[model samples]
Target: MDQRVSSLAPPTIYVVDDDDGVRRALAFALDLDGFEVETFESGEALLLRDGLDAAGCLVLDERLPGISGLDTLRQLRARQVALPAIFVTSHPKPLMRDAAARAGAPIVEKPLEAETLIAAIHDLLRGPTR
Candidate 1:
């Protein structure tokens, strides 16, 4: 019933962050690099999305306002959706990094580098090990 669901595509990337500027920047950069990108204002917005295509990676902010990014990642995994996610965070704590690694996701720092971000996206696009 959702319009977004009707046009989902594999190899797509979703950027979820509370900051409008960050979301826009990431989306623009990825779009220029030939990736279909969708921006969400919050983790909840992303959670409500439908028709997830395989090979898609979620780029979520670790400090989302309402729903913490770690919790969101846990919920997704619990639902059997093994999406490869790259967390963007301003504060990089050891516990956060460990948790992200445990979730099989990578953490990219706040001021993201273009090449590194691209590489992370590429790795996610590669999908999980068989």
Candidate 2:
């Protein structure tokens, strides 16, 4: 069998942040950590893309250009795409926390500790059984 044909792809981390600097930094960090990373400038872009059903998780920014992170997650859930998500925000409010919790996504406040974000991603990928 051809190695390319049989080889499995690495798990992907879908990152959606409007800020270029933040998005790039996250992609770099997650890439270095041995996971494939895909980035989008806004939640809308992520929703427009296909292949979200792939094995992986999402790292979304709460304040997006068009749709908020919570709304994005709600849309994904409506479509039956229950990929584990970690929401990052610089200014988190109680309402946002409540919404995130309702969507089954954990919200992590910024400036993000690399270890914490990485650990969250790992834990999410591991599934709830862990």
Candidate 3:
């Protein structure tokens, strides 16, 4: 494959959330917004996936069934997956905020507005928030 060809491909957004409805909604919205979206139901499922480096970003839920989103981020970092990430959670606690900051991932709270989440993704893609 040509380098130029691959470079022209749409960016892939990896979404890790337990809720089926959220995943479907996100995938649909993001696709409509002209991005390639992949959905994972758990941190464990995401961890099992290959080519994490190929993704443009990750939108993760703070509380997951298998491993919390924070832990998933930790594990990904441990494996040297440096993709930009953000948390989409409802009312994240202070501790989670601190951890997310430490990890350099911004948190966009739930009841999510497409514009807000999209803006966050675009901003993070442009440059690190920190």
Please give, for residues 1-130, the per-residue lDDT of candidate 3 as tens digits.
Answer: 7899768878899999999999999989899988989999999999999996454899999989979999999999999999999999999889999999999999999899888998899998888446
Task: Note the residue pairs that clash in candidate 3.
Answer: none
For 19-113, candidate 2 gives per-residue lDDT tens digits of: 99998999998998988999999989999988784598999999999998888888988889979999999878888888888877888889988
Model 2 residue 39 distance off true place after TM-score fit, in angstroms = 0.4
- Which parts of model 2 have CA positions greater than 4 angstroms off? 1-7
* Order of models, best TM-score first: 3, 2, 1
lDDT of each: 0.84, 0.88, 0.91
**lDDT tens digits, residue span 1-130, model 1:** 9989668653788888899988888888898888889999988888898876667888888998999888888877777877789898977899998999988888889687767888988977777669
Q: After superposition, how far is residue 46 of candidate 3 from its true place, in Å?
A: 0.4
Between candidates 2 and 3, the lDDT winner: 3
1 versus 3: better TM-score goes to: 3
Off by over 4 Å in 1: 1-10, 127-130
Taking all chains together, the TM-score of candidate 1 against the true structure is: 0.86
RMSD of 3: 3.1
- List TM-score per model, in order: 0.86, 0.89, 0.91
The residue-level lDDT of candidate 1 at 55 comes to 70
What TM-score does candidate 2 reach? Answer: 0.89
Better of 2 and 3 by TM-score: 3
